[model samples]
Target: MLPWDAPLAGRLDRHPFTSELLRGNPLGDPHERPLWVYVPPGYDDSAERYPVIYVIQGYTGQVTMWANRTAFRPSFLETADAVFAAGAPACVVVYVDAWTAYGGSQFVDSPGTGRYHSYLCDEIVPWVDAHYRTIPERESRAISGKSSGGFGAMITPMLRPDLFGALATHAGDALYELCYLPEFGKAARALRTYDHDVFRWWDDFRSRPAFTKPGDESLLVAFGVAACFSARADGTPELPFDPVSGVVEPQVWERWLAWDPVRMAPGHAATLRDLRAVWIDAGTRDEWFLDLGATAFRDEVLQSGLPPDRLHFELFDAGHAAVDYRYPLALKWLAERLAR
Candidate 1:
């Protein structure tokens, strides 16, 4: 692997985007977000249009983290550049930022987080298409991500079949009963310090170094996801489970279940059928048990009538944290099948 800060054959362009949709959001996050686009090696030398891949991030992941270099591993940007330089299919890769003060936007539109879904589909997609040499069609466009971003990839194409037609999810969140319900009890115990009120936990969280408290991560996820999935109309995050008792609030929790890809696939059968490619993978030992979620998602998509030939599914040997190497693999897979 190349050393950190090595030069790339391709060029990465960073653009600042001010979103009208996110202005004055409940969390008071900045509306001006950083947008990064990676153009393949020969992009500037040729007039050819390219397929586009939208890269979404996991919870609490911001755009700059894509450049994060681990020991003996190059960043995804470098590895992806290698793919193009070696003459695999070329594409324009877009890294989107959907961060909120709590951690992430979950890439959904809610009264609590503002219209992030609209910002991505209606604004960012059009902006990128208008400014770049893109095929500008759903068949040539895809979205990929891990965790929360993975959930976004799984649903965006279904919600807007007119915009995206392909997706790759690396242990993307799903099978809420398995992936999420387990977290409820843990979060409830953590909520004890704050009187079983997530807002109180939130206020204390912002007052000091994050994650310093043992319960910070679990509680943050509880609040952040609730903010994304079940916030009240007035913009207050409503926990799907009672924070003190860990009792499932059936109605609120159902709203969260409604977003699970496994449950959603049956309703989006027509949309899944139109997808050119779908890649689903997870570590067999994923802490969240997303490997099970992946299997369930694959089975559900197949039952929804997506051609078996169009999907790629795998359960690898590792867990969820250091799965960056898998990104380029999926990119290559998608590049070959995307309209070229």
Candidate 2:
């Protein structure tokens, strides 16, 4: 497990709830993909179907990253009264661990990662709706994420309006500018040397051209996901932290392109018309270098001719701290939309 991953299993207690995982699900390969499920207290034998939200995360972040990464339960609960607090028409929140590290999984289909888009749309969602007492109707299903996840929520609803009814995003991770950079190119070439677990391969990504330093993710915060979503030749995952290998793999770059929501959104303009609701918000003070870019994406998306009522965009005075202002607003926004 990555260093950050080690802390998660223990911190599970922090939540005022019980969480479970799926092990050995060869479906979301590379890392054994698991679904972290949280059923509110009132979820006991109620025989009622609840709404569901898929919470995705940025690069390098796992499904449980938000749970372990932030102190959001209290605020998120109150803001999303339906899911968190007293269970007012309570719902289910699903966090699917997407691509991490090397740099990808805007949560779409990619040549490198097999058919993740199909997996979520075809497998994951179906599994959730089948097993859980979820409100299986598209109107009852919602999708949201932070940074890269935000991009996924934005792009997914636009592409597959039939599956998800509502969308919410915060401090989104938009990859409009990063894919063409030199480092991404280099990593694409050296994909063969990737170290699946310990990044026992390639040199640190800091040396790549025009690439943001691993820690210097000023323009964006999708690196954690970029690494996971990115794969080396032969279906191996890329390790942005690995320094001995010294470069990017080729298919890795393809995977990056595959997940880039910016490149694909323009073509889906008409699809946006079907969306019931859409929301985009980010911290103006976000350290990620792409706050301006995030705003630009929101504007461009709105300009795509989707009704003004369907698009919701906001800029707040917060930085990139998770579980604080952003989380509350995101959940509240989703609740409001799903209420419709």
On lDDT, the leading prediction is 1
Q: TM-scores for all candidates?
A: 0.98, 0.67
lDDT of 1 at 290: 96
Q: Could you give candidate 1's per-residue lDDT for residues 1-340 as a string of tens digits?
A: 6565988899999999988888898878899999999999889999999999999999999999999899999998888888888888999999999988878988999998889999999999999999999999999999999999999999999999999989999999999999999999999999888888887888898899889998888888888999999999999999999876899999999999998999999999999988999999999999999999999999988988889999999999988899999999999999998997
Q: Which ten residues in a row have the lowest lDDT in candidate 1?
A: 1-10
Stretches of candidate 2 above 4 Å error?
A: 1-32, 69-83, 86-89, 99-104, 178-260
Index of the highest-TM-score prediction: 1
What is the C-alpha local distance difference test score of each model?
Answer: 0.93, 0.57
- Give a tens-digit lDDT track for model 2, residues 1-340: 2323221111111221111221222234454466766565556757767788887776556654443433324323233433355334456777676653344456765434455566678767887777777887778788987776677777777667788877887766565454235343344334443443233222445346535433234222323444336644454544443333434445555665555556566777776655667777777787653466467767667767768887778787777665345665566556656742
Supply the TM-score for candidate 2: 0.67
Candidate 1: which stretches are off by over 4 Å?
Answer: none
